[model samples]
Structures are given as C-alpha cells and as structure tokens.
Target chain A: MKFSATTALAGSLALVLGFAAPAFADIKIGATISETGPASFLGDPEAKTLKMLVEEINAAGGVNGEKLELVVYDDGGDPNKARTFATRLVEDDEVVAVIGGTTTGTSMAIIPVLGDAEVPFISLAGAVEIIDPVKPFVFKTPHTDRMACAKIFEDMKKNGITKIGLISGSDGFGASMHKQCLAIIGEYGIEVLADETYGPTDADMTPQLTNIKGKDGIQAVLNPGFGQGPAIVTRNYAQLAVGLPLYQSHGVASDGFIELAGAQAAEGVKLPGTALLVAGLLPENDPQRAVVVAYKEAYEKATGKPVSTFGGYAHDALRILVDAIKRAGSAEPSAIRDAIEGTSGLVGTTGTVTMSATDHLGLDLSAFRMLKIEDGGWKIVE
Target chain B: MIMRLSSKATTLLILAAVIAIAPFFFPSSYYFRVGSLIFVNGLAVTGLVILIGYAGQISLGHAGFAGIGAYACALAPIHLGLHPALAAILGALLSAAIAFLVGRPILRLKGYYLAVASLGFGILVSMVLSNEAQLTGGPDGMAVPELGLRAVLKAVGIDLSNTEFWYAFSGLALVLGAWLALNLYHSPTGRALRALHGSEVAARTVGVDVAHYKLVAFVISAIYASVSGSLLALQNKFITPDVAGFMHSIEMVTMAVLGGAGSVLGAILGAAILTTLPQVLTVFQEYEQLMLGLVMMLVMIFMREGLLPSVAHRIRGRGE
Candidate 1:
C-alpha cells in the first residue's frame, strides 16, 4: 500500500490526461473541429464560439466550484484523423466529454469509437442520420435533412408552390435532401418537374440547371443542403430567369449564398435553420433573445465579428456537455451521458435543449425559422 | 538464418516481429485500437503489394473496392435481406467485377496515365457513394450491419472484446493474405507477371501473355482490397465515402512503398508504422499533414527501398 513516487506521478498524469488538464480546477469539456479543411468556414467559428462560452462560464464563478477547460482538436474533416483525436482526448487528455466534428461523415466515423468508450459527443453537422442507429452517448445539435425537407415543403405549400424542381450534390448531404424532397414534395401537392445532380467538387451547376430549366412549367426550385451546389443553382436560376421561389436546405447560410449567387439571384431564396440566424426578427420575449444577445456580444469581443447560429450550436454543444458533467458531479462517461440525456429546460442559443433516451435531437421541428435574402442579409419571412 | 534472409528481408522480418508483439505490452485498450487499425490498413496494403510490387500496375482507386465491401454490409441486409457476412462476399464480387472492367480498359495504360485513370475512377466512386442517398446514404454515411462473426464465434464459446477480435482477426487476415501472395510470388503465373513487370514488350515477345497475366493480377488484387474493406467496415460497424476517397487509395500505396512493396510482410510493416505513428503523434496535431508529407518525401527519396530495406542494408554494411 506504500505508493512510490513513480506510481504517484503516473496516477496524477492519468487524472490530468484522463479527464483533461485541471487548470480550471473544475469540469473540462472537449471539442474536435475541422479548423482547416474545406469545411473550416464552419469549424473555425465553432472553435471560436467554444472559447467564448468557456470564458463566460468561468467568469460566472465556474461550474459548481470548478472552471471550464475546453480542449479542442481539429479533425480537418478526415475520419481517420478524427478517430486518432478521439483516442488522444479519451486516453491522453482524459476530457470528461467531447463535442464538435464539422461533417456528418467524420462524425459518423468516430461515433462507434466514442460510443464504445462511452464518451458523450455532440455534432453540429446537418445530418439526422448522425443520430439514427444512435450511439447511447451521442447527440446532434442541428435539424436533420429530413426535418429540413418537411419544414421547407410546408412553407412551399403555404406559398402555393406546386410544381418544383430539385437539384442536389451527388454527395451524402445531397442524397438525403433528394430523398426528403421526393417524400415531402408529394404531400405538399407539388410535382417533381425535374431532378438534377452534381458532384461535390463541381464548381459549375449550369449543365444540370440547363437540363432542369429546359423542361417547361417548373414553378419552384428546392436546392437541397450543400455548399457550392446552391451557389451554382442560384446563379443559374438568375441567368435562366427561373423567377421561382428557390429554397435551400438550412445547411446553406444566407451570407455565403448571397455572396456566391449575387444579390439579385439571392433576393428571394429561402434557407431554414434555428432562430439564431434571424434573432432580430424574433419576438423580444423569444427564448433565444438572451442567448443571441449574450453570444453576439461575446463573439464580437472574442473574434471581433458577427456570429452565426453555426457558432451558436458549437457553443451550445460545449455548454450542454459541461452542464451534464456538472449535474453528474463526476467525470465518468456513463454518468455524464445520463446527465445529458435527462437534461430538460436547458436554454441554448438555438432553443431549449432537452434530450431523452428515444430522441437525441434537442431542438424540435418548430425550432426551424424560414428566412429569405432581402437587401443583403436574411429577413425573417413576414 | 538471418543471413539467408537477404539483409533487407532480415530487417523487415525483425520489424514485423517487433510490431506483432509490441501491442501485447500496450498499457491500455487504446493501443490495441490503433493496432487493429494498422492490421486493417496493412491487410489492404498487403493486397496492394501483389499489384504494385509483384505486378507493377497501380490502382489509385482500390479504396473504391473497400467502399463496395463496406456498403455491401451497410446496404445488403437493409435492402436485400442478406447477412452482413454474405454482403461482404457480394461486395468482393462487385469489386472484382468492377476492377475487371476498369482494368480491361486502363490496365493497358502505363505509368502516370494509369495512375491518373485509377485516381479518377476512385473519385468517381466516392462521389457516387456520397451522392446516391437512397441506396448508399451519401455523405452522412450509413451504419454497417454488425459482422456478428465474433458474436457467432462467442456463442460457440469463443468470447472476445471489440479490440481483441479485430486485432486477432486482422492479424490473421494479414498473415493469410501475405501467405497467399507469397505463394503466388513463387508460382509460375507470379513469375510470368513479374517478368512482364520487368519489361512488358520483352515478356510479350517471350510469350508470357502479358495482358492475361496483368488482368489476372488486377482482379486478384481487387478481391484482396475488397475483403480488407469488408473487414474494416465490419470492424467499425460503419462505412463512409472517405473510405473510398482518392486519399485513402494513396495512403494504401504509400504503405506498400514504406514496407518495401516487394515484400508482403514489409508492406504490412509499413502500414502498421504509418497507422500507429499518427496515434503517438496526435500531440503534434498542427504538424500532422506537414509531418506525414515530410516522412513520405524523405522515405521515398532517401530510402528508396523503404524503412526496412535501407535499415537492413546499413546494418549489413556495419558487419562488413
């Protein structure tokens, strides 16, 4: 029972690396992001917001007499790299819980490894399948492709969109949106006039758009969740003068779409996401008001720029994981996972986050807000 | 016995033996996790050794075969009512068929032309896997049906954990794959293919049936890649387009070169080292790509024969 100095040192290192560095003398949570990939546009801000939130939590006297140490790994949207980082965080860093992988593909790759280890993970990637066949400790912070389809279709229905054409990336995000489009378009009394597809690295969508536009009587266009796919689609829609109510999946932010598509092309295009995008349009008493205000102030101070809801989810994911650690009162993975699942009425920038065993998604279908580009930015549809 | 190995093979044998035994002393299940990954990757690289080393043809899209094998497990049971194991076989068949077709046309091309053709083929496959949502579940990825091999084995009193099963299974697969490939290396067909690799026109003039041997090599290597892919997907219980991406294909090739592609065991050694090094190097996160690029450049340029071959040659010089 006489512990040697080596044994004591090893144990201390295990503790420090087991749940993370204890600089905060409190619970520490970790996030792995793609800070330098094609998806860094999403991952960099996410990392920044994580810092802002951790700082805010520490300033408010820390969590339950402990401070927040937010450890982050840049996945760069690679699956192999993500798995290695997950191990380093789980074994070397010993962080209580981990969050953030920019793309669903990378998120799905690490899900089993994280699950087998019982570490809680939250992803910001816009894929519902990330939560399906669910890992016990995994949760996602975005609306699903299916959910986005249903919401967009409902709005399309309300706006009398009956004849619609669909264009999607031939990638996973594109395929899901295509399926969702096929399923929801029918219910909204919408006919699929034309369906076209393009590759992920494709910089031009003109050929596919020409095919769709060549067909007669297509009244509305649904460009499913993608990056360059929407940019190409919107620009083509303008050049072709389709004049249709072109809707994009929530994955496409208004800023990029407008910048890529030109102002006239993006003038009436719609994208769906959590209300954090158009916080100014929500009622004063909206649940997101305080979160938006607080996050905006923090983000500007931290990064010296405007913040988007993508960053909001990244912040929320870290906060929720930390909150679970606090409630569990221990760094045990199973304990933290249960604490996260049972959390209810936890206010986040997106909405009230409440996850249960059956549903790992926090925000509901009602949480999606429809916004369009008016002058230069998103305008909440009146 | 050591002198009989040729200094290069002697060094590779030592390195391989060391890696095979090293994980036993791993302080935690974490190293086993990485060990199993190396085994999986080495299994694929072993297949590449037959193609790249023995046959002298290149496949920049072998990962596409891995995707087929992976999605076979993912899509088969859900759509076709097949078992995961059966799906793996079916995927292997699909890969062989595709390789046969793709090889027939582009195997005729040599050097950079063949490399670029294979690279294009790989990118196209990844795009299809990511884009075709209904069948393959595109970029979000689909969960693979668990292999249940371990579960079935356990039911018959063969109990194993996730890490242990993959570790032993992938290791066994590598050995078997290497043994088969080694057997082929000594076979008449293997000799004929190597003859063609040495000089295609000379082999053709000498009646080696260069095209036939090349096609056979392509299909056989494709099957190896497919089975490796199936094992990887089964091990993880998931599959994504990244498995079939051009980058993974290149990684497999680099691994083959790293171990001295001429030796199957050496290829596995290369795969094991590359797979495990990143785990240890995670502390140097920012320098990852830079380090990988540098290691690859230095190894290929200075150590043209590979880590094992060059080290073995240097040690032999000391004796002289």
Candidate 2:
C-alpha cells in the first residue's frame, strides 16, 4: 500500500511537471463541467466530447499550427466549486477562452468570474439570462428556453392547435420553460387553457395531468420539464388517454426519455430538438447535415455512447472557439472575443451559427428540428 | 489562568499568522479565492465545534441558516433597500431567532431524532428558496449586490483586488469567530454546555439548566453558519438554493469532525484540508471523486481523532 501510494504521488508529480512545462505556443482552453454529479448526464458527454475533439484537432496538425491544450475541472454540480474553478481557469491557467457551464446555476456562478477577468466564455447551459443583458465577454451555445418555447408554439400553430393545456415541473428548467412559454404564447396566437406543475421528486404527475385533461377546448398538451418528471407525466398522459396531440419541450431530447416513458406511451410525442438528434434523417442538401452527422459518428465511435443534444452544445462551442481563433489570427483574449462576436455562417452540429455584436447565441428557432418519436426512434417532422 | 489566556492568544496568533503569511506562498490569485472559502467554512465549523464537540449536540441542517443568510444578502439589498453589510447582520439575527424557536422543541429530542428534525428544517428552507421562483429566482439562483466594503477601502486608498479583499475580510472574520469560540471554551456557559454533554442528568442534578445551555449553543452555531453564508454570497456575488441544501449541512459537520471538532485550531485545519483537497484533486479529472473519497477514508482510519488532534497527539507521545 505504501509503495503504491508513493508511486501514485510520484506519478502525479510528473503529471504536474508536464503541465507546468513551458508551453510550445499551445492555445489553452479551460472548462468547468459537472462531470460526476446530478448534472453529469449533461456534463459527462460534454467532457468526453471536448476531450475527443481536442485530441482529434491536435492530431490533425492542431489549430492554427498551435496545439489546443484543454484544462477541464469537474464542478460536480456545485456552484461554489464552479466559481472556484472559473477563478482558477481565468487567473491560474490563463486560458485564452473557456467553455462548459453544464447547468444554469453553474453558468450563472461562472459568469461574474469570467466577465471580471475579460475572458471569452462559451457556456453550454440553456438559460436566456446568460445572454440577455449580455456581458461583453460571455457567450453560450445551447438554444435558450425561450427559443424552445417559440419553436414548439410555431409547430403547434402549423398544426392549427389554438388552445393548449400546460403541465410543467417546478424544477429550474421546467419552471423557466413554463414561464417563457407563457410569455410568448400570445405571439403564436396560442392560449393556455389549463396550467399545472409537479414537484421535482413527485412520484406521480397524474393529478396535474388529470387537471390539464379536464380542461375543455384544449387542442393539445405541452409538458415542459426535465429528468423523470417528464417521463412520469408522459406515462400518466398516456394512461389518461388525453387524445390531444402531446408535445414535450427540448429538455428530454434523448432516447433515455423514451425508455423511461416506455415506447408505446412516447410514440407520438413531438419535441423541439437539435439536428444531432435526427442527423440520419436530414436531407443531403442541408448545411447542418454534414456537420451533425460527422459529430454524431465521431462521438459515438470514440466514446461508445449515443450522441446527445447536450454534447452537441459543447461540440458547437469548441468549433466556434476554434473557428474564431483561426479568424482572429491571434491567441489574445480580446481578439478572440471580437472574432467570436463576428462569427458568421460557421456550420456546427447545432446549426449554421452566425453570431453578431448583439447576439451571443447565434442559433435561432430554425436550429431546432421538430422531432417526433416513432417506432421507438426519432423521426424528423418536416 | 495565565496559561489559559496565553493558549487562547496562541490559537488566535497562529490562525492570524497563517492567514497573513499564506498569501506570500500562493502561486496566483486563485489561491486567495480558495483561502477565503476555507476561512468562511472555518467560521461555520467553529460554530459546529461548539454545538457538536463541546455541547454534544448534532445538527444536520445548519445549512438552512446559511441559505437564509445568503438569500438575505441577495434579496434585502434590492427589495428592502438595505446595505449589504446590514443585510448580513439581519441574516445572522434572523438565523439566531429561528434557531432559538426551532431548537427549543427539537433540542428536547435526543440523538438521531434531533438530526432528523434539523434535516427536515434544512429541506424546508431549501424548498421555500427553490419554490419561490419569482422572489428568489428559484433554483437558477439570484445575483447578490456588492458588499461595497471594497469600494469603502478604495476611498481610503487601500485598493486590493477582489480576491485579495475577500481573503482579508473573511480571514479576519474567521479569526474573530475562533477567538469568540476559544473564549467560550473556558467560560461559565461553556462549562454548563460541556457538563450537559458529559451527562445531562448529572448536569441537571448539579443545576446546569440543560435545556437553556443546549438552546444557547444551537443559537450561537446558527449565527456562525449564517455569517459564513453571508460571506460566501458576498464574495461570489451570487446565491443559489444549493447553498442551503442537505449536502452543504453534511459538509459542515464533516469538516468539523474530520479536523478535531474538539479544538478551534483543529476544526479550521479540517476546513482547510476539505476546501483545498477538492481544488487540488481536480487535476485527477474523472478520478476526482475516487481520490477525494480515498483521502477522506485514509484520514479517518489513520487519525481517528482528526488531522490536527491526531498529529498533536503523536507529537506529545513522542515527547513523553
């Protein structure tokens, strides 16, 4: 035991020295992700994707002839730890740019640290506040809850569903989406007939589903939630036979949701999801098809895990940062920030992202493809 | 009496020296942030030492008070138009009052009963903080207003960086917190609490007023936790519901017990170890949790009494 302990210590000392060795002009990119906690479902893939992408990039003669050095710290879904890691990334590692904030809380905690340091940060979390009243140095990759709502409402309008019943989880993602949907339901000429919510740990959402189902003249039902809450709601919705076309938010745009909700119950459910979810279904002429397919294939091949929309967010973030570095022709923080802001027509797994001075999240409602679950698989709804 | 006085001064002196001199050894400003976090945690653990180590009481929900304190800084500055400093005081007072009320009934229960009741209290606070989205920003958390003390210092020509200011401020708070706790160790109230801890029945027979002493310890600890929470919120400039979650309460107790809950210096050492361990262990990447768990298990197994106390015991044994 003592021998192994000494060996481990020596190994770590060597690793530290390797890291501390004078860089050969490598462009350092730091990330703080919740790789092993409550938010690990989102972050585990993100960390993997970042590692795989950096290795692939380095192997392909690196970015701008400089190797991309990646520094990642697992925040374990703790905001305090996230803040500390953000500080370390900015002050200690002195990274040119940062990516990865796996949850809204962690992203919010990191924003101030990165903003103060003037380091260009690309967050993976899906919160509107991260960009709204935007900080000069902060950006995000995931489509916001507001955009998800807008996409869902647009689809509902195309289907001629005027009035809908709303069921949402009281958790962060669910509550935020619920509020965003309510705010813009008027814009799409949709009115919510019944609105209900379930707690994060609520075993059965039957009571809430029943309340929504009881509402008259409701053309469809929209359940906006993440985790098992949505799965439970879907199960209850199927059991109740609400009959209206059921729509879910982009929160559960994974195969895991279908397995949890059962194939039959989730069969006809439609949700706003990224191109990565339906990469195989895209047309040959589509701009994002190549990008999404390449990412999906590479990610699955490397990790032996199915590609997720969450991982795609990190993929887009890293791609955008690299593209920005290439365009900037420099590794300076401010130059990178400006170059990121001026990003245009950069095809990524998410979409053909075109960031501007005013917009940090370049993806629009079009970036989300309306996908319906059919035969226990994702089918793109044209 | 002189020995006791010098011992108290010695602990304070050592803590102050560590806080002041540690900065010189820091490779970067990140260490300052980590150091400040350790001090904030140390303040809270010192309170737990009083409650669990001296008073022989356990609380698994002290983070509830911390959440109250943190949210107070976030909300009061905006809603009530109070200064951030005053908001911190209000948070501490509110925690003390709530602890007084909640401790009365729950402190009557012994052992696991007290722990469970306190755990429920913490869960209830976090639930309120999370559920009240409009007021508290829900689980996404809310940004806290600046404490403005740095600005005050700047006006007086003392311009430290944000991390440096927080390090000095929180370190000072920890020193004050430790001084008070060490003083309490030798006070009349401390003896009553310790007497009850040894044997409540015997203490009652000897006129210790067991209930009053327990309540006193609980309130004091709650205040300590509240102050610690305020410092965290002010330094981060953002507050989340997780600050008041069950995990945070467990972390506070763990830090106290893992250091030597019996001594002020020992508890601080525990806080330092836990805080720095996570930061240092991040280099292990995916193996971070495994490494953290292994380190903790090894420490508990080897030391048994905690890092500082066990080391001190070894040194004394060698001397003998």
Chain B TM-score by candidate, in order shown = 0.91, 0.97
- The digit string of per-residue lDDT tens for model 2 on A1-382 reads 1222244346446555765343568899999999988899899999999999998988887788888888898998889899999998898888999998898899999999999999999999988899998789999998888988999999999999999999898878888889898998999999888988888899998888888878789999999998899899888888999888999988898889999999999989999988888889999998899999999999999999899888998999999999999999999999999999999999888777898888998987789899999989999997
Off by over 4 Å in 2: A1-23, A201-214, B298-302
Model 1 chain B lowest lDDT segment of ten? B1-10
List clashing residue pairs in candidate 2. none
* A127-217: candidate 1 lDDT, tens digit per residue: 7667876668889886677778888888878887778888887665676678766876666687888988887788778788788878888
Q: Assess the local accuracy of residue A254 in candidate 2 as a C-alpha lDDT between 0 and 100.
A: 83
On lDDT, the leading prediction is: 2
